[model samples]
Target: MRSAVVAASLAAVALGITGPAQAAPARTSAATAAAAVTSTAGGSITRSEIIERAQYWVDQGVPYSQSAYYRDPQGRTYRTDCSGMVSMSWHLTTSATTWTLPDYSTQLGSLDDLQPGDALNNVNTHVVLFVGWTDSSHSTATIMEEARPGTNARKTTYSRSYLNSNGFKPYRYDKVVESPVTVPDKGMTNVTAVGDLSGDGVGDVIAVEAATGDLYRYNGPDYVGRSARVKIGYGWDSMSDIVGVGDITGDGVADILAVDAENGNLYRYSGPDYGGRSARVQIGTGWDSMTNLTGVGDITGDGSPDLIAVEKSTGDLYRYSGPDYAGRTARVKIGSGWNIYTSLTGIGDITGDGVADILAVDTETGNLYRYSGPNYNGGTRVQIGTGWDSMTNLTGVGDITGDRVPDLLAVKASTQDLYRYSGPSFPGGSAVQIGSGW
Candidate 1:
């Protein structure tokens, strides 16, 4: 049931570009290309956005050319071949050929598993979007694609049998959810902590200006230049007070949890941005005893943000599961002797076991250690590296490489230079300098 145009397009493309085509002179440099076609819109896109983008290509009445590339009104460029069309629809980082597209996707078992925004890709030749099912059997589907050279983009019906016969496989883009970004510094000095404040899965920096006791939030490193500063709150005058950032409410937006050094009280703040906070909900009364307070991420597996705190005097570690820290007895003692550590932060699933892990810097040596856990019960620990003593500040950043594993961001104390270090378990090696001068 494959449309004649789609079949012909496959044949035409197979005879066309066999590898990445040399981008035309007018095309933007690959490094400067947007992460997705609709990067401006921000956050994970809706299924409707995918469909609308595909429809926009059709509405443009762009005649297919093997080497034709179209720049949308928003300035994203799209090639007009089959994989190009799918790449544009998915807002891929760049134009990828059918053979290379699978590298950016997680393979699906069958056409029946396809979703509205999923793809039907014939490895090496053609790719199309699965809009919906035309039949309950899931054997036939409504697909959209740029047909062939000289043809216009169109929606057509295709049978699973026909697609499978042609070597078509199904895949979902690995970035179906937007990866976390790094927050740029905009006069952000003394960055005490970092977290995803905008809840876009990108990590923003939290800085306390010692001069004014004012706290500010900067959009993570996804933007081109220095991110604009958004003042979240005031009266955080002390640098000693601890701050933990995570989506505590499970609302998909990052929130703030802080321990006021003035009073030893823990507070949670709601966020879309940091401008306004919810009424202060005191999680604990005597936070002054807590040291190395950090967000450990669902340590209890309860689907809510769990916090880790070390007893200042004893170095005893405790995991506090929360509805909002109100339950007085929610604390579970996880380990002891944490006082030997100078810094601790969640590295976010570094073990690749689907559970968030903890990273601690040894106080005596500045060595970095990764602790794997089901719930921070002193689980297996491994030393990832040493020489972290040079870092003045360190915190868990959400995914920066788009590999789905969260990375570590550090600020060199002496230079204030920013560097992103990949999880040892991820694809890349350690440390890419992200910015200079803090």
Candidate 2:
């Protein structure tokens, strides 16, 4: 966001001038993991898409300099400085200075108001695209910026102390549209919003009472606790591994899948009509040897939602092709040595990759790791949190709070209390106890 003078300084830096160095986010390569974004100017942008757009420049290794302008893939031109970089990322019609950028954004009161793809601006000094708070304590921030002359557009973490040392103010662009996950009272039922069971856009919780064996659907207000729940089925106490895989029956309505406790057989519960579930239909047999069962949405890139199972004996992971409605197909092995994890659950597409990701808790380290789709190769994990040794169950119940990120439910081993970790929060995770007597 610096002006002509800063541009000149950048030019000098490019021409062999330099200053105190700063570090960029650690990476195995300069290459980016996010896919490229193809967008035109002028329209609402989602937070994930904004990050994708910003990543384009980072992928290109666009250098920081004002003397020359940068042209985006959409053929838009903007200054090569920090603000110009933000302009391109936001897909602004034209480059806006730091002072003028405020015109298109709302100033936030505190760091907690921050979201990915927002901005932190110190007018006339600099502007950086706010990626997100690096930790739950709001102690550090991750940002993408054209940091002065000679430096390339980069992403790195900075301490809150340093960011607040300047006159930085948080701002969210007016046209920014968050992901479907919005917050409190946004159709979140008081009970867990596990997955959409009522064919509504908002996810509905399908919970089985431990003693009564009654399956209840919680739909209506957002988040867990006070939502209205209706008994949908009886005798679910004998079933384990309940999951709401997206529309697997090709019936246009989402269906619930569960494993019968007596047998390892998995059954699909497609509705009798559109309103209520039908009798259990066996789809897969001999699943009793599976250590984990998860219905990951469309992981195969096909229209059908797929499920993954970890072999109880070998610690191997296999994907069951969806539309396997008739019966289980030859399950495909996607990853091996999964037994090292104490738990694994399907988190609906945390990355904007169209395929759902898996969350695994390492048995030895108790580390929680998220593996982005399309496959779970061994080394692909990025550790998101640790100290999860006592977790008895982990369910990623899509997005509940509408934070443009997914929410997770973890049942504690010692207390059986249910804890919720709202989206995009990890490391310094914010675990809010949402329920008890799970």
Candidate 3:
């Protein structure tokens, strides 16, 4: 049971994530017919006239016949599923219930048929709407819909294929839609660790097959295969749990960081190509088992980038002073106790002190510890979460609510619950639960 708890906490920290410059919505095409209008004698109506009709439906929230469906054996009334929620949203947008059936494939085209304001049917269970694009290719797109129980409105990105082929098929209405749908940036995976290795200011991504030691890199837009990986001897073996990304090296260009599990070595991004640059730089040696690693932007007040690493086995924290690692690094031990550390998070100005601070999670107890100035040993420690929960991966920390200071994010893998804590200190604000119970 204890082992299960540790494993759960580690999994969540390994997959937290976020994004870049926002793009404008796609423009509508002229060849299509507006869904709101119907021709009586011959020709089509004007675009502005069709938009006026669609706006009328948007004002009135879509309604359903609660009095019509039968109750299940569990005494729950069948109101709506993922598809039903989407169908309702569509009716609100176009005021048409003509395609209200459970199947969306029959009404839509293949994934390629998708445009803005289109219905995505997993054919059987889920339904999502393509609303906007974020990238050069039409492959990644943003979706807005009522997907879960309490989430009536939410935004997430999906590849055109996962949005289509995961279900039986896709569907598209015959008429014209208000906007053109473009793909989103390579959709951010629940998996974190995305950025460019060439230091071009663009983010690149890398993925490793857990079953085999196969490694892959995401160049501009493609996932190119790299050499087979091997284990580095230390606390564990190999780069089993890893996050691949880029940064500017001494020359201010992008360099890669492939953190290995057992040895905790960082493989620097060599040149422009996504190949292994040089050998791996062994960060630390001894009984320290490194678990989580991250780039902290100039924590030392230097002009170059700095770093923070956490030892899941030992609760020790180390800070890399600047861009180069020629035996120039500083180490600070944060919290002390058996199993006192699980994940580490870097927030620029975490204390709102104009400098970045560090947050460490105690796995055994869901407590959060913060390190304010460069003096890691001087910061206050606070209890963030309690009662039967293990904090894994401090994945995302941002001003999600626009409070100016970022919230601490973690996942409780055992229950599959994502927890967010708003704070600069404890008496830590309330924790809100997000995502399906995890």
Candidate 4:
């Protein structure tokens, strides 16, 4: 009898309970659509994309069909149920019911926290995408949902009181592609590092296949739809050993800097783009003790890119200004206890003060910290955000928001979803989903 009860519960959870009949309204206001596009800092799907997809349904006069599924322009199939419409808008790998969507979302405490790409969900029943707030008090919001059977997918306004009374819970999807433009990885996996390799102003992604020691680069954010794969010597299985990538040569184009995992030797490779025959220049040895590595821009005010490294044992941070191996200055001790950091990156001019800042994520708590000044020495340490432990990798991806201040790009370890955090600082800031499915 217990086994039967368990099975029944599982079934109930799979097929969520139906909610109130959806009101088939017209498209949302232009301001609401515009807000959706610009409100989120970074995501694979912008508010505009969501509005566009939802609008496509409206234009097609797509009637809600539990038995039939809607096919996206990419030829992906999704059920026409309420949850299915959300799944399609979210670009999820597969359709999910209301009960299962919370598993892929971060719960928001109140409707006041709602953003364009966020969602309203009642775990037992219905789900809706939040487009924008309808009133100054945020008591009412404009939303898009499939509504109910026999109804066409449409946008409608709902009062917060009505939604809360019906058990609707606000949530932000874990995988948000704030920007629709993306470069699909051509069978690449285990992205160890990312940077702007092509000097195109847009950041690119780097991946290393451990089994093969093969390195691949993909133009990102504004994906040009191509990749360049090359073998970087051999025996490079340790992802942590590979360090920074930037314009190390003082050239306009970016370069790749890596530490030999086995020998602790640092090497720099010059070639702004792929398909160019380039050779590696060994910088120095004794990098085996380095726990973390980052490219600090012109710490010495020199034209070339400088470097920062952390010692694994002592949590000591060092700044190395360079012109290549012998020309590089002696290591300058900058900070200590850096070993407690799981991820570190040099965010360019985060304060908009004409100086670069260092961003670090705590290993234990996932709390984010910013070290701001001309250099790491005597810089102020400010706590940015907590609960970033889900991040597997974090790096500075230039000024993604076009705000002059640099932003951060992060990858979730479990879902491999990409996120971007923008603003003058991370404190009181939020990350929007930029890419999904690794």
| Per-model CA lDDT versus the true structure | 0.58, 0.61, 0.39, 0.57
Between prediction 1 and prediction 4, the one with superior TM-score is 1
Estimated TM-score per prediction?
0.52, 0.52, 0.40, 0.51
Q: In what order do the candidates fall by lDDT, top score first? A: 2, 1, 4, 3
Between candidates 1 and 4, the one scoring higher on lDDT is: 1
Tens digits of lDDT, candidate 3, 277-390: 244454434312443455555655656655555454444556655454323235555444323444455544654456555555543333455555454553365443332123
Q: Report how far residue 327 has shifted in candidate 3, in Å.
A: 4.4
Candidate 1 colliding pairs:
37-91, 180-201, 181-202, 182-220, 182-221, 183-220, 183-221
Compose the digit string of candidate 4's lDDT tens values, residues 1-438: 000000000111111112111222444434333434332222356655665555555545567777789775455788888888887777677788998888778998878887776789987777888876533334335677776654566654454544655678888877665554321121223343345655666666565543354565656563222233444343334323344545556555556666655566777766543222246677788776665567666656776666777765567788877657332257777787666665667666655455566777654444677787455653487666654544545666665566555556665432345666664454323566656544
Candidate 2 segments exceeding 4 Å error: 1-194, 198-201, 220-227, 271-278, 325-329, 425-428
User: What TM-score should be assigned to candidate 1?
Assistant: 0.52
lDDT of 2 by residue, 263-296 (tens): 7687777742222225667777876566456767
| lDDT of candidate 3 at residue 126, scale 0 to 100 | 56
> What residue runs in model 3 are displaced by over 4 Å at the alpha carbon?
1-237, 240-246, 250-256, 261-264, 270-291, 310-316, 327-339, 387-389, 400-403, 415-438
RMSD after Cα superposition, model 3: 16.5
lDDT of 3 at 295: 54
